[model samples]
Target: MTLLFLHLSRSDYKNFLNFMTELSYQCNITLHQSDIFSFLKEETYDLAIIDAFNPCSFLVIEKLGIPFIAFCPGLFINAGRVGIPGPLSYVPEYKSSLTDRMDFFGRLKNTLAFMVSSVIVMKMDALFDQVIDEHFPAGSRPTIADLHLKPELWIYNVDFSIEFSRPLLPNVQWIGGLLTKPAKPVTPELEDFIAESGESGFIVVTLGSMISSLPVEEFLKEMNDGFAKMPQKVIWRYDRSDWPEELNVAHNVQLVDWLSQNDLLGRVFVKHAFGVGTGVPNLSLNHKAFTIEQAKHWCYQTWKKVAPQLSYMSGVRDWVDQRK
Candidate 1:
C-alpha cells in the first residue's frame, strides 16, 4: 500500500524523513513525498499521514476528499475541539507546569492560556485557508476550521496515563513510544566512561532535538559551578566543541557531541532529571514532577503498550483495524 507523507518546513521534513526511512525498511511500503495536490490527484493511497503542525497540508488533503490521519508531535490540541473537558480546570496546556490537580488560581491561568492558544491556532488556521484558496479555485476548498475536525484518527505523541483524566473520542490514540526500539551497544568511549564512574555514576543531559547549544552564558556558568560542587561526574550531549574556559575548569563535567539517550536512560541514574526549563521528579519521590527515573519508567511502559499493538511484521495492523 502507498502512503503519502507531508510536512511543511525543511527541518520538520528532515526529522520525519529519518523516521520514515527506517519505517519503509521494515514494511514493504511505497512512500510519496512530492507535491501533495498533484500526487493525490494522480495516485491512490491506502493512507495519508499529515503533520498537524502544518495546517496548510491538512487543508490540501481535505480538498482531495481522501480519508486521512493526523500525527501531532506536540501536546493534544483536539481535546477541547473533540467535545472533551476544557483546559480550564483539570487539564494543563503544553509547557504549563501545573499538574492535573490544580487550585483556583492555577485553573484561572490555565483557562487564560488555553483561550489565548486557541485564538492563535484559529488565526493560523485562517491563514492556512487563505493560502489554500490562493492556490485552488475560490469555491473548491473548505476553510481550515471546517476541515480540522474531519480527520478519521489523531495519533498524539503523548500518553493518557501521564495526562489528566478526561473524556476522549474513539478516534484518538496515544502512540507515544511506538517509534522507540531497544538500545544498541554503546561506543567504547562510553563504556570506559561508565566503568570509570563506577558507584559514583554519571548523569546524562540532553535538551531534546530542538535545542542544539545552550542559550545563555550565565546559565552555563551556573551549571559549571554546580557540576564542580557535585560528587558525581556529568556527560553532557552538547553540539558545541568549544566550551567556555570557566566551564572547562570543572574537570568533572565532560561534554560530548552526542550520546545514546535511550541507552543512558535504560541505565540507573539519579531519580531527578533536570533540563533547562523542565524538572522531572521520579515516582519514588513525588509523581507531580518530571524525573529521569520517571521518564525511564514511562519509556518502558510505552514500549509495552506499543508492542502488543504491533502485528507480527511490526505493522500496526491491530491499531488500524481497531478503527473499525
Candidate 2:
C-alpha cells in the first residue's frame, strides 16, 4: 500500500515517520513525504493522512481521488462538518475546560464559541478555495465545503477522561496520549540533587514552551518569593542566566537552563497551570502543597491505562484494510 502524509509540523513529521517505520516491518508500504505541492495530480497513493489543523492542505488530499484519514494532533475541530456537536451544550471547547455537563452560562458561552469557530472555518475554506483555483483549473477541483463533507475517518489525539462526553461519528476514534513515552534517564547531577532532598523531595516548575519565553518579570518575582519559603527543593527551568538582581533565589531553589520535563515529571512533584501541555497524566495541584498520597492513585490509574508504549494503530489498520 502507498500513503501520502501531508502538512505536518516538524515534530509531528518525525513522529508520523516513526509510526510508518514500525508499520513497514509488518507490511509492504510505500510512503511519499515531500514534493506534494507540484505533484498532486501526477502522483497517487492508496491512502492519505492529512493534518486536520491545516485545512488548506486538505484541498490536495481531496483531489487525490483516494480514501484519506483526518489526523488531529490534539482536539479535533472539524466537528460541524462531520455532523458532531462541538463547544456546545455538553461538548467543551479546549479553552473552556468545562466537562460534558455545563451550567446555563457555560452552555451559552460554548454556543458562542462554536459559532465563532464555524465562522473562522468558513473564512479559511474560502482562502483554501482561492489557492486551489490558482493551482488547478477552474471547476476542476471540488469546493472545500464539499470535500469536507465526504465520509472519512478522524483520529483525535485526546481522550474522554478530561474531555466532556459527546457524540462522535462511527469513524471517529479517541487515541489520546497514544504517543506518550517513559521518561529518559535523569542526569547524574539531577539524580544527586533528588537523593539529597530525601523525604522533603523536589517540585518542578516549568511554564513549558508556550509561556516560557514571555516577559514575566513580575511573575518571576512572585515565584521567587514563593519558592524561597518552601521547604522542598525546587528545580526551576529558566534558561536566562541573568535573572533580575532584585529577586533573591533561595538556597533550596535551583535554576537550570533546561530539564527533561517528562523525566522530571516521572521523578518529582509538579503543580502547574492549565496551559499548553498540562492535561497529561499527572497530579493537579489543589493547594499550596499536596501529599504524594493525593497523586498516588491518579498516577497508578494512568500508568495502568496509558503506559508509555504506543497503542493507537489498530483503528488506522482496520480503516486502511476496509478502504482497500
Please tell me which predicted candidate would have the highest TM-score against the true structure. Answer: 1
Give the per-residue lDDT of model 2 (tens digit) for 148-237.
666478777766564446777788888766756787888998888877778877778765554443255664555566566666677877
Instruction: Give per-residue lDDT, candidate 2, residue 288.
Output: 11
In Å, residue 142's CA in model 2 sits off its true spot by 5.0
What value of lDDT does candidate 1 attain over all alpha carbons?
0.53
- The sequence of per-residue lDDT tens digits that candidate 1 reaches over residues 56-158 is 5565576566889987753554566544455467766543445567799988877766766576455444434435554556766566666668888877776
Query: Could you tell me which 10 consecutive residues in candidate 2 have the lowest summed lDDT?
Result: 285-294
> lDDT for each of the candidates?
0.53, 0.54
In terms of lDDT, the poorest run of 10 residues in model 1 is 281-290
> How does model 1 score by TM-score?
0.62
lDDT of 2 at 170: 86
In Å, residue 128's CA in model 1 sits off its true spot by 3.3
